[model samples]
Target: MTDAQLGLLVATPIIIVFAVALRRMGAVRTTGAVVAVAASVAIAAVLFFTQ
Candidate 1:
C-alpha cells in the first residue's frame, strides 16, 4: 500500500490501543479516546505527507 494508507492503518490501531489503555488507567473515557485518536492522526498525517 501507499505510504499514506499504511500510515493510517498503523496509526488507527495504535490510537485505539492507547485509548483503551487510557480508559483502563482511569482517565475520562471519552477524553482519552479523543486525545489518542487525534494525536495519532496528527502524527500520521505529518509522517505520511512529509515523506
Candidate 2:
C-alpha cells in the first residue's frame, strides 16, 4: 500500500480509541464523536486511494 494508505490504516484504531474515550470524558457528544470518527476515517480512506 502507499504511504497514505498505511497512514490511514494505522490512524483508524487511534481515531476510534480517541472517539470512545472522548465520548466517555464528555469532551465529545456520543453521536458527534461517532460521526467525527466516521468522517475522519472516510477522509483518510479517500486520501489513501488518491495518493
Best by lDDT: 2
- Candidate 1 TM-score versus the reference: 0.55
Please report the TM-score between candidate 2 and the true structure: 0.77
Error of 1 at 38 (Å): 11
Candidate 2: residue 25 lDDT (0-100)? 93
**lDDT at residue 35 of model 2 (Cα atoms):** 99
lDDT of 2 by residue, 1-51 (tens): 777688788988899899999999999898999898889888887887788
**What TM-score goes with each of the models?**
0.55, 0.77
Best by TM-score: 2
Candidate 1 C-alpha lDDT tens digits along 1-51: 687778677767877787888888887677768877788878777777776
- lDDT value, residue 17 of candidate 2: 92
**Candidate 1, position 4, lDDT:** 74
Q: Runs in model 2 with CA error above 4 Å? A: none
lDDT of 2 at 27: 94
Enumerate residue pairs that collide in model 1.
none
